[model samples]
Target: MRLKGKVALVAGAGTGIGAATARRFVAEGASVVLTGRRPGPLAEVAADLGEAALAVPADMADTAQAREAVRAGVERFGSLDVVIANAGGHGGNAVADTDDEDWRLSIESNLTTCFVTCREALPALVESKGAIVVVSSIAGLTAGPAVAGYVTTKHALVGLTRSIARDYGPRGVRVNCLCPGWVRTPMADEQMDELVERDGITRDEAYALVTKDVPLRRPATAEEIAAICLFLASPESAIMTGSVIVADGGATAVDLPTLAFA
Candidate 1:
């Protein structure tokens, strides 16, 4: 009931964290507008949410489509109370081998999409004094061997969120970023399989190796991430703004061992 009578727009709502956030929002009494590249998956989620959900198929990378998606949501729900810029992907490329195309694509997919959606939704959010929750990643804070493009783009979002929050918090618009670690989503599963094939290891071994740095010894669940987003979107976090909340199971807290010391 925290979101009762609120209107929310969730991008990338076809699966994973986006889908989980949509479902959680609807359950809390918010009428949701769910958008994703695939119409089938969006429609399925909307159907499951009953009358409170609207499925709007869109590719967030397209600036025009992203703007129209926000506009359509406002048209249906009368006003917009929350916006979740959750559409992004990881492009695997080492810094040495990354091409301009790969870097640009990663920027467009992760950072540009959030920029477009937030710009489009700003007017409506200002009118309603709503909150914006951006879904970033733990890679934004820590470094890895590969995924240079992904790491940079995710880090860029944190900066953008803070800037927007600083400028608009006085105007009653709250903006925050949620940085999640490895989560058991379809995308994570694909990454795990790719590691297995690349490293010639069993699936279990691949998962364990990847999560070895995490103190929890396992990845987070989609619902767990959704719950955090819900709290941020609700009045419970009214005093919170320009915050970077990390849900990484302490993966980034561990220090790498020095060769000389070892």
Candidate 2:
């Protein structure tokens, strides 16, 4: 029980990495307050965790809602020891193809949500000398094809993580960023569906095609990313802060030129 007697507020805890992280934290003896835009899934996850989880459905991008979520967690658990800012969505299309609405939604979904949620959770975290894990994307460090909005917002999250770490380090709050590549989540399934439709290939084949150049030759599972979040949130990484962790199956390690040879 690495997190025994701890309390965690996990934004976007309804599905994918967030849900897996919530489950992992609970298994490690941490109570979690789960918040997300979807009420049904959020409630389901919370219910599954029994008394250890509280479901709060709200958009983290909304300042009032974000603050309320933090307040609710602290009130329910008596203290907040960790935060997982895992709320984000993909922004489709290239720069020229992306309309203003798409760009704005991407910023709100991927960046504003984390910014607002973390900002609200800072006071509680400072009191507990807790940690904040910002769930960025591999796109934060490198670009993906035709996802300019996603790439931009994700990259901005890295800067956000560093800035928060620097500003709050003296206050005893550790902030770190997690960048995962091609995680096998419901969101990724949509991308696979696109490929399947376009190429007349199976979903598994699409995933394989996408990860062909990756050293692991496979996409990461949500549980795998959740394990990394557990490390960052637990005392295991006590001395770590302002660090950007890449869990991309070695996708970023390969040189594009060398991939041709491989």
Residue 258 lDDT, candidate 1, scale 0-100: 42
lDDT of each: 0.91, 0.94
Worst 10 residues of 2 by lDDT: 253-262
Question: Which candidate leads the pack in TM-score?
Answer: 2
Model 1 lDDT, residue 133, Cα: 98
For residues 12-93, could you state the per-residue lDDT of candidate 2 as single tens digits?
8999999999999999999999999999999999889999999989999999999999899889989999999999986879
TM-score attained by model 1: 0.94
Tens digit per residue, CA lDDT, model 1, 139-239: 77886678999999999999999999999998999999999998989888888998889999987787788787678877889999999999999999999
Q: How close is candidate 2 to the true structure, as a TM-score?
A: 0.98
